[model samples]
Target: MMQSQHPPSNYQNNQQNLDDFDEVWVPNPLGQTQGPAATSGLIDIIKSGSLDSLLTNPWLVSIFVATIISVLIGAIATILAGQRSTELTPEQEAQQALLQKSQNLEQTDNNFREYLTRDDNNSGMVSNPGLLQAATLEAGARYRNRIIASLNNPQNPAYNQHEELINYNSEIEALKRINLGASGKEAQLKYVDPSTGLWVTIPIDSAELAASGLTKLNIISNSRRETTQRFDLVTVAQNIRKILSEVKAARLEALRVKGLSPVASELEKTDWFGNKASPSEAEISDYQQYKPEPIPANPNTSKQTQDKPSPKPTGGQDDK
Candidate 1:
């Protein structure tokens, strides 16, 4: 009865193996799960329920580690490929640049339109004088070209307008030529006749009807010449101004395309012809201020009205 009782030999060996397994793989005391691959490997080893079996099969650990490494490498490659795909190509970059330039042109056109619509008193003059001048000339050239195109096209019905413009310009040139040399002698007036649409020249002597004892005729002829002169001058000036406004918009767009800033003096300087490249402030002001003369009452119309003998009062009610 007093003899010492020892544990069974198989039980003692199993206890020793359990102790060895705990030493080889000790889990965190906090009980938090490990990474996917590591946790899975631990699960496989634990499911075997025998440390001797795991120790005997070393190929199992090799396979788990290899799988994790391959997965990590593949993930890294995918992330790198995604990043490369996001980068822009050279052709795409060029297209973006062109789109930006087109936007600039559109913006420039809008800005110029706003500028033109402002009141003359408010927008008396621009900081850059040359801009207006360059824009004006550019606009005129464009208008002339468009008119020529219309003339060339069979579908266009602006032939009359083009003819009038050319005729008016020719008359202006002719007037300038005749007036330059006549300092002592009175300059004869050359004008386009509204009735015939032909150039008509009134001789200096005929225009001076007071000396010829024909005061009324002389006055009428002189008045016609004066009115014609003013009309032609104003028409040409107005046309140029209208054209200039358009050109200015185009010039602003061009500057934007080139990525250049406008210069204050660029348009202020004269061209090869020694003429100012743009309209002067005085000229612009004159155009803005110009008011057409009210048409004079015709003597014949007034006489007819006086003689019309108040339409013999009909028997109808005056209210009706």
Candidate 2:
């Protein structure tokens, strides 16, 4: 017997087995005794360590973070670029302004044409009531001045007693019929106050004055009588017509030069007078409702109305 240091029977056998197992010590590479191995594969080391003990590799984290940052930056840049592209630049703004001006001119021209045709029931050849009045007053003053000058000039046949005087008196009488302001004593009393016994002037409305002026001119133009000197009056009227045509043509040219063709064209074609020849209610309504197109450059491509002087009215009642 081996001195029986071990327990008898199977107990001794079990102890010997335990001792053999204990003597066989296996080496652990990750254990404290071996210290830490050079961490080569980061994934493997992380998998082996405790949840909290695992090292946070900045490089790996940075890769994912950088990708996200790049994506965000790209998104912001795209939005800014889109915004920049859609915005109107200064050149575009200028073009738009020119276009608008052309349109306005066209509308104005259309209205003028309509007034000239006398299509609207209103008189004085102006679509704008206020403007018509002003024009009337201006014409009245001009005619008065011309008459006075002719009378004062000794060289003028109408200075003392001539056909011109008779014509002038007739024109004056016609103007008085279409008077914009009160006539005779009423007009003079405007500046005087009867209630206060003081000199109080009542200011005339600008629109009213303008209408008066235009009315005077219209009357004078319509009241021309055929006389031996009718040709002279015809020449004067023709000159005035030429001046008006020149002004209109210049305005159209300006619009065209500015590249506002559409507007200018609209203005050129516009008829200021509604259908005066046909007095249908529907036609009148249509004229009132009509809105002219914007002005385009070169509104009138066609030749202007014949500039030929009108034939003088027969003098002395044709002596037939």
Cα error, candidate 1, residue 127 (Å):
32
Count clashing residue pairs per candidate.
Answer: 3, 25
lDDT of 1 by residue, 1-320 (tens): 69998976746744443333342356533454445655555576779697876666566668768999999999999999999987779887766766776676677667655554432221323233223333333343444456567677778876546544653554455444444434324434444333333334555542342232232222222322211111234444454565555555466445544555454245434332234556353134232334533222222222223322322323445525
My TM-score estimates for the predictions, one after another, are 0.22, 0.23
lDDT scores of the candidates, listed in order: 0.47, 0.48
lDDT of 1: 0.47
